[model samples]
Target: ERLHSYETKRANLQAIERLKDHLISVQLTDPSSKHRIRRAVSEIGKRLSSIRNLLRDRKLELDCAVNAAENFQDDLKKLQKFCEQTEKAIQLVESATIFVPSGTDLDYVRLHEPEADEVANRLEKQWKDVFSLGEAVIDEQFGIVSFDTILEILAV
Candidate 1:
């Protein structure tokens, strides 16, 4: 059961990474939006941190539930709320158009984006609706190859 939950969470993170790529790659159409785009990437980092915290907290709470001899109702409710919050946050940042900042490193994006094509395609197949027009970021070292991301998009 936990494996399934982790799988869902992984997908959500993948989608978010793809969105980050799109924001970096496309925002270059306007040179003035670079700062705003940079800030948006920073905001994406915050969202990613929140998602991970929610997952970790849920797992800890589940452990408490398992150890309890009785009255696990509250733990279960908290877990449910965590799940809802995770999905809500994912939906909030799933689209680049909604959050991409105006100022972006267009020159950097043009040079590195082609390398992301394959990974982006795989991510698209995995979560079509969530990843708009973006490439899958395949970084072997947990590094952001094209965009500014808090976490690396490990090629899955």
Candidate 2:
């Protein structure tokens, strides 16, 4: 199950990268052919939207699994800590930028005051949606682990 989750994530990441490359190609095309570029961009955007939805659904499943695991752990404190850390990791994955930031701390600024900055707001909004999906995927996987452990103990 964990391996499945990892593969899903890797595939999504690759799709996103390809979309970025497509966008760049559209941008660099001749101005006389701008209309064609616009059409291509529109199609790419739709595909990306679909991918985002798929990622979100996977993330929700992951979240459900994580929550179930918490109930079975013997040490509540340790379980809680693990849950928190897992959530953080998921959030980090969600917030990952398609384009690496240069010298500017774009991510930090975007997180702190996205509303005031137009560029930051756009970037933040896009990443937030993606990240939310990733978080769900992580949670569901954790839940799977919890369920498997319970089954193992019961079998004995």
Q: Specify the highest-TM-score model's number.
A: 1
**What's the lDDT for all of these models?**
0.51, 0.53
lDDT of 1 by residue, 69-113 (tens): 133334334433444444444444454566663333343344434
lDDT tens per residue, model 2, 49-122: 68767878999987985765553333334333434444454455567788433523434433433232333334
The total of clashing pairs for model 2 equals: 12
Model 1, which residues run further than 4 Å from truth? 1-28, 70-156
Any residue pairs clashing in model 1, and if so which? 33-102, 33-103, 34-102, 34-103, 34-104, 36-101, 37-101, 119-136, 120-135, 120-136
Give the TM-score comparing model 1 with the true structure, all chains together: 0.30
Q: Model 2: residues >4 Å from true position, as ranges?
A: 1-32, 74-156
Model 1 residue 84 lDDT?
A: 45
